[model samples]
Structures are given as C-alpha cells and as structure tokens.
Target: MIAIRLRSSCGAALVGVLALATSGCGLSAELDRETNPERKPTPSETRAVLPPVSATPSPSVSVQPVSGCPSSGLRFEVGRVDGAMGLRAMTLSMTNCGEQPYELNGYPSVSVLDEAGAPIPGVRTAEGTDEVPVAPPGSAPEPFTLKPGETARAGLLWRMAAEDGTYLRVAPDKKRDFVNVRPEEPLDIGPENILGTTPWAPAS
Candidate 1:
C-alpha cells in the first residue's frame, strides 16, 4: 500500500488542494495537461517542399572615357553681339567637321596674333559677360559633347586697339596647336579688358 504524509504550512495546504482536485477541480487537470503538452507543427513537419534557387547571369556593359575633339575637323565661327560703353560682346562658335563625336569643355585658350602669326604680349584673360552668353554659362567648366556638324560656343570680349593686334589665335585647353580667327564685324570693346573668354558649351 502507498502511504502519503504532509507537514505543516504550505505543504499541508497543497495536500488540501489536491484533495479538492479529487472532488472534480479543473485546475489540477489543467495543470496536468500543461505538464505533458501536445507537440506543435515544425518546418520539417509539412509535406510541401520548394526546390533550391538557381542564380541567373546578368548582361555586362562597358563604359568609355570622354576625349577632346581633334583640331583638324573643327571649324570656328565668330558672331557679333553688341557694343556699348566701350565693351564688345561676341560669341565664338566651333563646328565639328568629322563623322565622330568629340568631347570638350571650359575656356578655350586665346591670344592676340600679330601680322606674322605671332602672339601679342600683355593681353590678359578674364571672364566674359552675358551680353554674349557662352555655352555652359557660369564660372565653372562643363563637359560638352559635339557630334558631326554640331557647333559649340564661347563668349569673346576684347577692345579693338589699332595698335594692339590683327588676328586671334584660339585652341582647346591643354592643346598645343591652335586655330587662327579674325572678327569680320567688330564690336567696339571700348574701355573693357583687351581680351577675355568664357567656358565652352554646346550651341542650342
């Protein structure tokens, strides 16, 4: 025969509660059910399965660096804007003659040329004004693209001094060779700087 004994205080109270459970208390049955709980579903319990994923290859793209335009295929054009207060406004335009696209930007190097094709001294470079807007206007330079037959522009500002010079020599920045240009319709750049240019931009 099995014999059970309870001591004083909490143990005795617990035994009294179990005696109530024998009289049909649900609390004891609920506790017993929780102690030996049913098993829950897990990932491996499901019969459905998904196959492993296969990676697909993506297409590749190659990028090319921009390059300066060749001087040989470029034709430069000068346009007259206005003349007031002794300052002349003009646009310097360059057209691409070749079949390929070329990249250029910033101010084109410029200098006054003498009768014998020599550069005149003492002519300094400065920023050109909007009276004759340059391509990619503003102080900074921007990358400009030119396709075949397309033109780019810069602003030209200078005073016409009979004693100064005859022709103008201009070239892409960092380029050794240059193009000789002469203003047909001269603007009376009276008291302004003797020479100036703006950063290059594509002509609209």
Candidate 2:
C-alpha cells in the first residue's frame, strides 16, 4: 500500500511540470509579436513644377538726336531767280560742305553796300511781291536739311534806282554776319525800289 501511494504522488507532480512548460512557450511567442512587426514603405520626396515659356520675341529700336546747323558749314552762290516780266532777277544758292548737313529755312538777309561801307538805296527790300507770293506763307518756317553735296535755292528780286553798291551781301535767314556774293551777270539796278523773293526752297 505504501509503494502505490508513492507512485501516485510522483505522477501528479510530473503532470504539473508539463503544464508550466507549455504556458511559458505561449508567453514567449506573444512577446516576440509585440517587439518586431512588418516594416512600412519609406516616404517619397515632393517635386516642384514650373510655368510654361512663350515662343514670340520682343521688339527694340534706336533713336537719333537732332542738332542745329550753323553758317560756317555752308557755301553761297548766285544766279537768275526770276521768271516774271517786271522785276530784276537773281537767285542765291547755298551748298553745304562735305563735312556735315546744315538746317536752313526761310529767306536770307540780303543787302547791297557801297565801297565806302554805307547802305545803298534801291537795295533796301521787303520779303514778298505781287508777282510771286512767299512760299509757305504765314507760318513758322519748316527746317530743311541741306545735306553734304546738296544745295538750297532762294530768290532775290528788286526794282532798282541805280547800280550803286559795289558789294552784294548774303546771310542765312536772320543771321547777322554776311557773306559777299557775286551775281551771274553784272546786276543792272533800274529805277524800281521794291525787293522780294519767292522764298527759299530745297533745290530739286
């Protein structure tokens, strides 16, 4: 009876040990699932977008400056200026030097002078006559450029009392300094005293 009791007690203790071992293995499996899980995908980088470009080109231009033309750049010559029956005829022509173009407008100041440096009569004159009206009348004169190798033509007509002056003087319009002039023919200053022109114009 004593031997049987010892055997029964041994069997109960062995069963208890097996149960404890099975519980420990299940706890270890739960801890491994909590510590290490499947990895998630890495985040991707964001990119910037740009605006579209146009196909057409922009336009550009250059401008030139304007300047005044003076007397020293011109040459003066004289010829016949009249086509009418009643007036003495002469034309004053100006040529610009090859150096540069000169701006000219209106009529030149003209005078006939004696050798003694006195103003001669019959050469005293006005700007217009009944035979030929002043061109571009009653307005500010437009400036015309006398280019290099180009000429500007003006008319000088008068009715004269005598051919008394030894020198003919010419100046660009309103300019005070005078250049001496020689007519194509010896001027015959008759008895008429009026002097005028058709005004100055660009030579064709």
The candidate maximizing lDDT is 1
lDDT of 1 by residue, 41-75 (tens): 33456577776432221122111112354547777
The CA-based lDDT of model 2 is what?
Answer: 0.55
Question: Which runs in model 1 stand beyond 4 Å of their true positions?
Answer: 1-71, 127-139, 159-163, 185-194
Residue runs of model 2 more than 4 Å from their true location after superposition: 1-71, 80-86, 115-117, 130-141, 190-192
Candidate 1 has its poorest 10 consecutive residues by lDDT at 1-10
Residue-by-residue lDDT tens digits, candidate 2, 56-162: 11122111112333447677777643322233556677777658776776767877655443456545556654433322122234578888988877666554345
For all candidates in order, the CA lDDT equals 0.56, 0.55
TM-score of every model versus the real structure: 0.53, 0.52
